[model samples]
Target: MLKKLLIANRGEIAVRVIRTAKALGYRTVAVYSEADANAMHTEIADEAVCIGPAQVAASYLNADVILEAARKTGADCIHPGYGFLSENADFSNACKEAGIVFVGPPASAIELMGSKRRSKIAMQKAGVPVVPGYEGDNASDDELIAAAAGIGYPLMIKASAGGGGRGMRLVEKESDLAENIKRARSESKQAFGDDELILERAVIEPRHVEIQIFADRHGNAVYLGERDCSIQRRHQKVVEEAPSPFVTPELRAAMGDAAVKAALACNYEGAGTVEFLVDKDRNFYFLEMNTRLQVEHPVTELITGQDLVSWQMTVAEGLPLPLAQNEIELNGHAIEVRLYAEDPSNGFTPQTGPLHIFKPAEGEGLRFDTGVRSGDEVTPHYDPMLAKVIAWGENRDEARRRLIRALEDTTVFGVTTNRYFLSRIIADSKFGAGEATTAFLQQEFSEDPSLQPAKLNIRQLALAAGVLAHGTVGEQAWSNAPATITPMKLDTGESTVELLVHNKDNVLSCRLGDQHHEIVLASIEKDTLCIIDNGIRQRCQYHRDGDSLYLQAFGESWSVTDLTHQPAAGANGAGSGRIQASMDGAIIDVLAEPGQTVRQGDTLVILEAMKMEHPVKADCDGVVSEILTKKGDQVKRKQLLVEITTN
Candidate 1:
């Protein structure tokens, strides 16, 4: 066994690796950037080392610095958790040359599977079903365009060297090919240091399922079922579950065998995942292979009751397969949802700030893997994912129910989150029927009325006002409060909520838009508010910062701002024709220049955040007057990017 293991990552993944390695009787070393001086992973490690600055290239991705940190800490091996250099074939080779064991597949295996073109050809040679496409090295734009013509319309252009849905474009028509191909090449170059791409026929609404495969140096490998990750937005996975509802026993066997073959074809060692795009007909085509532990590995652990990380450590120590294929058993249903500091209604824009309140849910068969605390600062330099909330049960429905409740039980404040968005998707009708597809957001929410934000009635507004005014002061404030509560208005999204409040003798009442309700606060304890209305008790947890109030209860989480002090209301694009960034990020492109004319809905500026690109488009025909930020400049939320004069 190794004497010590150095984790070459940060955030929750690093924390997870350290914990497992420590439990396996190995000293753990944590490496971090300057920005993560006081991060959770650093605080929990046996030894911590500062590698470089905040930028990934200077810090986590600096192979030389990371290897030095390992040597300084006397680490016998290095674990590259999920992202960063986890799949970098060069990094693995460096570790080998340095006499430091790398806890992953061989360098040759990584290089083979790292190339989408080469990997697909290898899989085809191994008799694994591969999607029909072109993987030729002649990837000139003209060559790709000709290849697309032969492949047919609506094909997928994917980066040959990267995953996580980055550098992928779905070209719907031949006319859209050039722009998408260029964008894919640029993003691919930035993300993976490679501009080469491969074209594949897009499988419409296929279930994005992947199998977990473990192998050792002794020519042994085993498959551990599969996970369904169909719930997505912008081609990024949000929710994943084990033992997919779509896959049956027979189908599981076939896909699992194919995944094992894909691994053996490269003499794979350590832990890796084989992804497949399974159509409705049960036919599965090989997707790419992830050459490290997955982000959603917990769901698989919950179902199989096995420690995959521990297995990885053992396998890397030159042990044979821990469990054969027949020894592994899928026991229960498990599901996981990624909780991010993002806004679902506002284009899923990533948010960054101090986490004022960071209470996570706790219960049976529920787990929360997080890296942030109440006072932690969510910086824009890293991914916006705050944590992953996962749940398990005896069956799929029970697991789904537990997951929804777990999300509702969570309370996060100070920044935007996708908590409510996650709840709504799990409760979606198509999801309830086990018919979820990649078009889940478009098909269900676009057609469902109830999925829209809930409008507050007079009663709810009265409660909200009372919480803001009398919060932390207890119910006794009602006695000294004004008899006729002040008339106030709050701004929530596009609606301006106006109401008049009346507080007298420990009771609160409100009137607005032909409605009225009286409420009495029973008590207050920290952030929990217990109130009584119409002889019914409702206990809700809330957080207050200035005029902003975030409340969660009764299966809903709402954020309301007290705009009573403001003199008037304003729409999102009202009056000022300034185009502002919707999130904190770097400028990826300046699509329109000053003095340039643009039509309505034309993209003017492109912002990159959390590895995704968001375009700032013109709302009306206008001429660009100024550009506030240029390409490669970092920006903050609501920061002005451009000025346009509408004609």
Candidate 2:
């Protein structure tokens, strides 16, 4: 049943494993990474290769260039579609020493659940309810602060070979546990060269849930129940669902029989998952085990009509276990979300460029697993997750009202996403009463920035002031035409705005303060502009440059300029350059060196990017005259890294 396969991994889970490996008739292949040469899963695979130079250690964690692009695309099975080299147990023992077929699991079960301290000591010797922490192997920082005061003070030090939330931390005092255990062992030795750690007990208001175990090659496993994922932020996940508006049905049959006894205590096969955490009294624990395939597995494939990449290619062809555990019937509520170019009012950051209007969100229980379209290019090299947006219904309040109408009928445009912060956390009310957690976006919308929504819309500022006061020469630019007024300048605080135009029968009547409306233009060419009203069309995007216009929408972006050509204000809100590097990272530590004097919010340089870190401070009183990128170089976006001299 496995005629071809190969994926290895790129965006949107390699276009969701080439649509179920072409609906199970297999033949896929893909691979990519010359910054995804023309991406979209390298133009819908069926065979494609390139494998290197876009740095994921020379392309998606190399592994001998993905086993020579699956032995030069003859494939026969590879599919590691979760993060690079998906759960690499030496890339599944180098695709079983090159005889290929590593659809997932078994590199001795990804080296016993890819080591989070040996999957919490094999889910506490498979009785399954683990998480009281301290996976001993003592690394002495006062013996991990007396094992985080014997696993108590809001603990969690994690990183015994961490995953996405990289090398964790959370202390909460014992005098900040020896500088957060030396910054989680220097970010777990710079992200998993394993600086070894483990302390646990941080659960307050947690939720994560998981379970999706599948196995085969004879040891048959089953469970595909839970999924919640508590809409997290720093600890990663951004919305995910599937049967969990706070799990039940007897806690989904006891976390699906403790996630199939933690995947038969690692004799696991094909797709994996397990995870857990729970807590608001429904109790649950064991939080590790994700050997592969999950970036919210399409909300467990829209509540289990199942297609987990065609059940990981029918359990890697060794097939068996084709649904049992009460024939797994979970048919309703789904959800998903995770669009992410990032920038939920800043601190979510990431955001790169070109996706100029990429639509998404279609009907019948919407899906969209996407890998970027409409002119692609969202580079900073990877994982800015350009698409997931699931939905499905029949329950959980119709899957949170169809995922807030599929995040307001999504419509990305050049970067900056979070699609209105996932439609304000699915029109939150403690996430519509199921009361989410992972600190639910820092406990109900971090200090309220008007609880999120409003990414501008007064019908998109009256269709960008009726396309700059009707300049499409519609009804002959309003007959007598003398009415070509402009005055725009309103960057969210609205200081100016006067636009007024008139184009009769061909309709375009505008006016911006006394309200008049009736735009309906729907397409203007050269930098595009689509308008419409009442039937709601709004698609304004323009770049122009010489007279400055910018505009963009739904992925928020703005700029207007043309203040009658001029520059006047400058009372120290400074912006001419120097103090650069706002992304494209790697510097990780400088803290002012050159002449070093520093003051006003000092920190000076840290950088890192994408896999997180960030610092770079000193914006007022300073001296350090020029550090200009050092600790590990790489630099780029706005590229300066340090210069300071406020003399």
Question: Evaluated with TM-score, which candidate comes out highest?
Answer: 1
Which residue pairs of candidate 1 clash? none
lDDT of 1 by residue, 15-74 (tens): 888888889899999999998999999999999999999889899989999999988888
TM-score of each: 0.88, 0.33
> Can you write out model 2's per-residue Cα lDDT over 29-120, one digit (the tens) per residue?
88887878888888888778998788788878888977887887778778888877788787787788888888888887887777788778
Number of backbone collisions per candidate, in order?
0, 1
Q: Which candidate gets the maximum lDDT versus the true structure?
A: 1
Worst 10-residue lDDT window, candidate 1: 567-576
The parts of candidate 2 lying over 4 Å away from their true place are 1-115, 118-161, 165-186, 189-194, 197-258, 263-328, 332-335, 339-390, 393-405, 408-415, 420-481, 485-647
Roughly what TM-score does model 1 have, to 2 decimal places? 0.88
